[model samples]
Target chain A: RAHSNPFSDHQLEYPEKPADMDWSKLYPYYYDENTKEMTKKVTITDIGCGFGGLLIDLSPEFPNDLILGMEIRVQVTNYVEDRIIALRTNNVETKGYQNINVLRGNAMKFLPNFFEKGQLSKMFFCFPDPHFKQRKHKARIITNTLLSEYAYVLKEGGIIYTITDVEDLHIWMAKHLEEHPLFERLDETWESNDKCVQIMRHATEEGKKVERKKGDKFVACFKRLPTPEII
Target chain B: MSLIHPIQDIVSSEDGSLIFGIIKNEVVVFRVEEGKSQLVGKWVDELDRNEVIREKVEKEQARQIAENITKKRKTNDESAKTIESENKTAKIPTPGLGAPTVYSHLRNVTLSHGEKLLIICADSDKSVIIFDIDNDNKENVLQLKKRQPYPKRPNAIAISDDDKLIVIADKFGDVYTMSVDSDVKKIDGNVEPVLGHVSMLTSIVVVKDSENKKYIITADRDEHIKVTHYPQTYIVKHWLFGHNEFISSLSVPQWNKTNDLLLSAGGDRYLYLWNWGKNELLSKFNYEKLIDKYITDAHLASERFQNEENNLREYCVSKIVSLPSNRLVAFFVEATPLLIILKYSPEDNTLKLFQTMEFAFNIITMNVNNNQLLITLDNHESQNKDFIKILDFNENTDRFSTNESLSNNLDTTIASTLIEDKTSHIGSTGIYPLYTTINLKKHGESYS
Candidate 1:
């Protein structure tokens, strides 16, 4: 139903800026008295994190780093929240998987509001809405306008990861990321060795669906280029 | 079953006979007579009792259940008969308006006057509820005395010790004060900005000076604390400045043995004690010193993630309560599992960090009554497992500890030494039926 509406309102509710956002409620575990501030930034974010299989797998691997999943669907977000709460409760003694959280947010519109400039280290767009029609391309997760917002939040040497079974969406994401002056394409070796890429390729429900269908997965990786130094 | 909302604020009567807690949509009063806690009275919004809305909501839910039953019946013949019978007899209690529609942000203040207890709570929906819990009656009953709506949503509320005046702080960085008997008036052109901050005000505290002059102390997100003359809010007494981050909590503790002091803690890792009357900084306690020794059981996502960067993890001081004999107990969220006790010496103007007590769960709110420390845990998991733990302070050890013997006794719901209530029970008397079958049928007709 959401994908069929090409002209649906894109505006979303967001905080004015990162300072106005209460990060403590989102990542309570990272708050400490010594620093007197939110110590951990959400270094990695998965846009349209459907079913959150990728986040569930990646949370333990990067136990120190904060990971966030942003999903637009309300029920999907609720499911993720319950899942995380269950995981946290079951592992309270060991304090396992306390680093990941999910929020119901329109990542395409509110990316800048949630993240400070140069705040993010990695961003993922896995099996996002293809929005195949030329007129509906703007609804696709990756776009030229959204890439600039992504670049503003991503730190220098940060990575933007994209993978999809649909070649159209993969090409759309790669073209937008490559066309943006602030990003550079990463070679195949970087994609092969990166632990995150491996998980993204196999962990998500979409990845599993593609595997069941015997479809090919197109993966693209891009690095956020540092700004040029002035003389 | 009643809808379970997390306890936001906890307040105890001065005589320690009663405790009032503001849950999501209602204020629950627990009577503590002879060391037994019992749910006596509750205050909920008027909208929660609108029968027309309740009928509509219930009908809709029942219709959906019926549809699901029919669909399942068609698929599985054996299971269909049991499902149909359950649907026919099982009544879906319409907890529509009974449960808070919007997650509410509530700040509560309680006052004791003779035999009556006055509790004021400000909700994010711009409604201020004043409830009177009268103990003079046979059973303590809670009555909604006043419900006032304002243009701006109030975030913090304070009642005078004498129970004469009520002051409310709103999200727009403004404070309004009026007699408890009178209604809150709208902000007009003639009204002067007496108690206000440039940023969102986090806390408002009322304290009477040595000369009996009433004063209001307010703290804001921008780290500014202002002391103003009460009633005549335009008269600025002093601005306490020095906090580098948002001031989340402000406490004015008066000890019979020592001078009255203002304690403020927030995003800045330091807890600053001030003499609000003189607007002078008395002492600052650096929390960084206690991190290594006290915070051993920190639940962080990553072991590699350092606790502090340059020196700020954005830890906030959520609660602070003062005890007798110049002692204090502070609950710091994101800082440690241990509650820090501090001692202040007026003569030397030195603040000594005393004992740190550990709790099993992450504490959300705490209140001190006599020698009992009542604490509410952050309930992010099972709502039915909420417990209010009571810990006794020992003078000999100079430390606070819970009775391990009583913690094992968990039969009662709300009265046990460790009070546990099923907050998520929808069929409980606390819920309001916000829906009905006829209304649901009408709603279904409109949609189809």
Candidate 2:
């Protein structure tokens, strides 16, 4: 019997609309500092948030902004969810990261489906897959087509921070990002000094693993361009 | 002085002033004007140097600075300059450490309405990548515009008439259509499947009828040519049959403005003309005689293959195109050294052999505009020199005339090696990229 092809067979499940999603379930304290009520927004997103290392490190830094971690795999998502729960439970007095949460999501397929137009300010693609072979190059997350979708959900001047231990994947991400009309390469000063970049480089599970293994990590950051005027 | 890199694919600007070629890991643009060719774009994918080494070097620098402070050495300009140089070296990202290559097999580039040159390339990574080539700048730049990852490898792609949608046919027999512009959201926020075939789809073309109805014409390895309604793919209009072997190429000839016709060619030694909407097989031109002349000359006799029951003389049509001059151009791989052009009539649904270009190398790729046809031949004898022959289609004579002096030839050793390596390593590694695989392993780890 032939093995059934499983890569893209199943219909990816998603919320009918971004607004229909229950934001309270994910972030209990998603309230504006002045209002002290539900703010109902996710300003930051980490795609392929493996082990939630970056999310955990970033949660306290931006306590007011709601950050969402989207991981496709159930276990990885669960691990992140559990890690967040533990942190919140242990540090209840600190108001403990009620603005951050993890959800199981396939960013490549459902990025635009889950986010509204210009909903996000910062997007992170950390340690993306290095599809080494030429044919599998499309499977790499940073592509021209996907960047358009990313551009749609990101606000004007939104920042896309991409980090990878694999040099090939880093170049791939940078090349695609640079080519997109909606995005421009962030200058070196902006990239080197950004707090999120430092946290992303040192905090992610892959980043930490690469550090331990003595593997090289390459980082590239781009800012989503404001809409271009029609010629 | 011309690009030394092998040309993987080539496309001309609609105005025909510039020539774009996919060379190795980058796309090179050449301006052809005033009888001079100037290199305008050389967009190369540069791998970012590993940061671990830079961090280690910085750590060493810090240790040295601490030691200097402890030793109380005299502050000197030379030492300061040395430290500054080291910092600069650390800042400069090195290149060529990794493979620094893109496995681009089949590529199609088009100039969009916004003056952007869009190149849709079939990457070795089982995904489709769109590179936006901007020529407005003094130095042309090729940037990655969009990318769609797939489970199965994409074999062929077709852009819609409006250039808003791209339909991709994959090896797993599924076709998907995605919007070219991200601002234009899907009707329901989902990429709809346009069509599917039981076998590997080799080629696809989006055609429109007189009623302005869009249809997707797809050909597969199983000798099936299917015409399905665009967007509403549940309705398969027709399946044009009668091929003895695998269908390799499909083309929608638009010489006649009134009627919609599809030109299909396969492993068999015949080309089929079909009015897919009406489910009519208009004509089938048997090219056995034309092919036999070359076959007999090359000593590849039909009688030698009579005993072979499984592999009957396979004359695959690798590339087929419909010229605006009421002519059909096809390249038969097994036939060798011959390019056949057939006169097509929409009124009577008749096709006749108009002309044949003999002694030409086996045509690997054929691109035709109104007045010119660019043909890339498979130079098996010499792997390095892959020449793209420019043939001018004379309107008065109705014949394609080759210009030997004007043709562009480049050493495609890199492209040939990539092709050979691709075939050898097929299915050896995990088809998915590292991101998906790691996530898959994470799934397994979480489950158990």
In angstroms, the error of model 2 at B113 is 7.2
Error of 2 at A20 (Å): 54
* Residue A31, model 1, lDDT: 88
- On TM-score, the candidate that comes out on top is 1
Best by lDDT: 1
Worst 10 residues of 2 chain B by lDDT: B434-443
lDDT for residue B308 in candidate 1, whole number 0-100 = 56
- Candidate 1, residues B1-448, lDDT tens digits: the string is 2335445567777666677776655566776665555667665543533343455467666776777778987787577667556644334355466585543344555555443646565544466766666665545477667767654667677878777767878765667776667765654323433445534667888887766777888876655676766665534454576775667778877573333578888766688888778767888988777755544433332333335543322245666777744456465544345577788766876568777766665566777776677676554344435445666777787677874433222113343322344432333343322111111110011111
After aligning candidate 1 to the native by TM-score, how far in Å is the CA of A156 from where it should be?
54
RMSD for all candidates, in order, please. 19.6, 18.3
Chain A TM-score per model, please list them. 0.92, 0.91
